[model samples]
Target: MLLITNVTAVTVDSQRRIITDAAIAVKGGRIADIGKAADLAPRHPDAELLEGHGMLALPGLIDAHAHSDQALLRGAADDLSWRPYLQEVIWPLLSRRTQEDAQISLRLCMLEMIKSGTTCFVDSIVPSHYDFDALAQAVQEMGMRGVLAKYVLPDALFGRGESPVDTGGFSGEDESLADAERGIGVWHGAAGGRLQVWLGPLVPREEPPASASPGFYRRVSRLAARHGTGITVHFAGTIDDPPFFQREFGMLPAEFARRYDLLGPNVLLINGTWFSEEEIPILAETDTRLVHSPSANMKMGEGFAKVPQMRNAGVTVALGCDAAANNNCHDMIREMKAASLLHNVVMMDPTTLTAEDALEMATIEGARAIGRRDQLGSLEVGKQADMILVDLKQPHTMPIHDPIANLVYAAHGGDVDTVIVAGQVLMQGRQVLVADEAAILEEAQERGLALLKRAGIEVAPAWPME
Candidate 1:
């Protein structure tokens, strides 16, 4: 049992309460109680005490969309348009990754995520010939929670789905489905309930007979429902996405998803940047979750999602750092700040997305995205003890007028001094507890170069060498 006392607790609960000089008690990997430090100290006298002066306790951030496999490609494919970048860079890089490369990439990915105060993430594993056991082991060893899935591209109505123009051919469609099934069977409920396996289908937006069929999605949805897991797919992300789907399928992406029974409480639609206003109601009515990756979208020239509109329409919107290749980092604090500022600037209304709104997206709403609302998300009693303590005494965060506002707008991921997930402290005082950080960093640097070499890609620095 652990008891953290003398902290400013930002309880993102039903009332969005903030309690100063408070304490939280943990027992059996769950939040046991929360109240004033003075009051709780006497009750749990024997609990291991953590001094939390000058700290702000809140629910650990949840990243609803991420691609851990792309963590090694940061800065290698920047400054390119989305489609070309995907076709020319990401796909090719993925093709050359080995099982050892993936394990190293995921370790680095988990390191960054844990350092950034992220307790849980939903990763869309890029399609490749790799080892799931190694990936799952890395995640488990790091003590991070994740929703892991293999990326599935269904066979198009015309024939097999089209691969990247430069890449030779798409792999077997039956094999892709089999891999997804095998992933679920092997990894679902593994890691002592710290990890879950989901189905991730790339949205069918390209022209048809090259587009994914309704039957494929229906089967995916059914499998997800039967497993009591979830399905995550990219939908209406680029400006051309909606139109392409509309022209090919005679409907918008959301409507098509709805018709195929893919829009439901168990579905998370990533990057709804191009969702038509008409589709908002469908999403709200179906209780579907939308994940917004502000930095990635802006970097890729994909327009910002209509988050304010979606919120007003009663839709649950969450936040994510899409991938390191696009966003260059998996810092949820930076993602939250980007999300808060992007909407306000796009709407030219400072009141559009408040700090509280952004924090909710990173925390509770994100839990809803991966279907873990009941167990994770908030700092309430009986919830899993997944939380972080941000040091407010830092220079940039000093004179904190409002802790929640400062957390969203001012604090950096490095401000997180301690992270407790499921009653276990994974990181304390800026140091990860589970893995050898220096070794992981060294391995990642070596493997990253080997990966680029294998893929026949060379990235030259733009500036002069020293």
Candidate 2:
């Protein structure tokens, strides 16, 4: 048992209340209690105590929509548009990635995420069989909580302007269910259920006739429901996405999902950037959760998500960093900033999104995204003790008028001093406890460059060092 005391705890509850001079007790990886430091100290006298003076404890940030495997190509594909970059560069590179590459990327992303104050994430890796073992091992080694799902497509999904068939010249339909079952069996409930298993279907609409039957998605949805796991899919990103679904399926993305019984308790829609006002009601009426990536969406010229509108419509909104290849960084701080600004600007109301709302998207709402709200979202008593200690003494964060506002607007990843996940410290004083940062960085750079070269792509010349 561990007792973390003497910190200002930002509970991030509905009232956006902050408890000063407070402490949280952790037992068996769950937050045992939280209250005023003086009041709670006597209750857990024998527990391992962690003093949190000069720090502000917040619920560990969550990344709802990230491609953990893209960590290897973090800065490599920046300054490019979405389509050409993913089609010409990223997709080709993904085809050649080995299990070794996946493991390295997973580790690299996990380390970066922890440093950025993200305790948990939902990764969308390329559709491949090797990721099952690679990511399972990588998550265990890294000590991060996440839902690792294989990126599945009925056919070759992204290299061409139009979707391509699998390499075998036949459809890759069976691959989806196979990978789903394989991932759930091995990784679900691992790490005492801190790590979740999920299914990610790459295609937003129905599969090709040669690839799968209409019942294929039904079976996939049913399987996810049966196992009580979450399903994440990139439903709509641009103006074209909804129309594309409409043309093929004769229904909007949300309508289509509902018609096929896909809208349920365990489904998350990534990047609902193009959702129309009409569709908002349907989404809110269903159990589907929405994961919004403002940085990536804006970078791709996708307009800001209707977050304020969605929230007003009673929709659950979660934040994601998306792929580093697109956003170019796995920084939840930057995402929070963008989310706050975008909503305020779009709504023409500065108070449209409070700092507390932005923080919830990164923490509690994100946990709700992957259906882990019961355990991993907040810093409340009886919740999992996944939290971060932010250095409030930093220059930018000093003179803190409002702790929540300072956190959303000023504090960056560098301000994160300690990160605790499930009662275990994964990082302290910016030092990762589970892996060597130098080794991981070196391996990712070399492997990523090698893969980029093999795909016949050239990069910008390195800058001269002083």
Candidate 3:
């Protein structure tokens, strides 16, 4: 049993309540009790106590969409638009990764995520030579909740129209499906139920030949449904995606998905920036979720998603930092701030999106995006104890008139002082406890250089370097 007392609890509950001088009791990986600090101290006299003076306790942040394999490629694709970056940099670099390289990258990603107060993330491993079992083991050892998926793409579409320029290493549909099944067999429900496996297919923008057919989607969807799992796909992020669908299939991406029975509560659509006004209702009607990567979308010059419209239409919108290579970091707090400001600027209405809205997207709505709302997300009684303590004593956080506003606008990921998941403390006072930080950083630096050299790719510095 663990008890945290003397803190301001920002319980993103039904009423969005905030309790001053509060206490939370955790036992058996669940929140047992929460009340005034003075009242709960005597009740849990024997429990291990943690003093949380000048701290704000809130639900741990969640990243609904991420690419763990891109950790090593940070800063390598700067200033390039989405299509060019995919064709010129990312796909070529992905072809050169080995199992060891991938393990190193995963470690770095997990390390960054933990230090940034992210207790849960939904990640897709790009198709490469990495060992899925090894990646799952690393995630388990780190003691963080994760939704892992194998990147499934049809071989016929690989290296073809609208895809990357170089896609020599991708697997065919049959092979990719087999690999996804193997991943499900090995990692789903592993780590004492902290890890889940999902099927991730790349929704091709261009019309695939009739020989390719809809059989690929039908097979994967049936398998996913049978296993009681979900499917995530990239949709309408680029200008090409929606236009391609309209020109080739005579409908929008959402309609195309609806034609194949792919839109539902279990489906998560990533980066729906190009979704037309008409598609918003379809997503709301089908109960499909959307994950907005504000930083990545803006960095790639892709137009912003109609987040305000989507949220108003009854669609759940969540936040994500897409990948280290694209966004250059995985800071959910930064993403939250970006999300709040981006839509406001795009709509030319300062009142379009609020600080509370951004925070909810990173918390409860993010849980719904990954289908874990009942167990994770909010800091509620009988819920899993996944939360973080943000130090409010920092200079940037001074004069805090509103806690949610301060959190979403002023604070950085470094403001997180403690992180707990499943009633276990993974980080305290900004120090990680589950892994060797020094060694992991050293190994990542060493492996990253070797990977760049092996891939024969050089990233020119924007400024002068020795």
Q: State the displacement of the C-alpha of residue 25, model 1, in Å, after optimal TM-score superposition.
A: 0.7
Misplaced by over 4 Å in model 3 are: 126-128, 158-171, 207-213
Better of 2 and 3 by TM-score: 3
Q: List pairs with backbone clashes in candidate 1.
A: 158-209
lDDT of each: 0.86, 0.79, 0.86
Q: What is the per-residue lDDT of model 1 for residues 63-177, given as tens digits with 9 covering 90 to 100?
A: 9999998889998899988877887798888877777888888889989999989999998654545577778878888889988876765665324444452121335456677
Ranking by TM-score: 1, 3, 2
Candidate 3 C-alpha lDDT tens digits along 416-458 = 9999999989999999999999999999998888888887889
Candidate 1, position 213, lDDT: 75
TM-scores for the candidates: 0.96, 0.93, 0.95
Supply candidate 3's per-residue lDDT for 354: 94
Cα lDDT tens digits, model 2, 1-466, are 8888889999876566689999989998888898898889898889888888759999999998889777777666766665677767777777777778878888888888999899888886545545476677778778888888755554434334445323322245575567668778877889877777887775563333333234666777877888888788777766767877777778787787788766766888887778888888988889678889999887777676788889889888999999888897888988999899988888889999988889888988888777877877777778888999999788888898898889999988888989999888999878898899999999988899888888787777487656
Supply the global lDDT for candidate 2. Answer: 0.79
Question: Which stretches of model 1 miss by more than 4 angstroms?
Answer: 126-128, 157-162, 165-171, 207-209
Candidate 3 — number of clashing residue pairs? Answer: 0
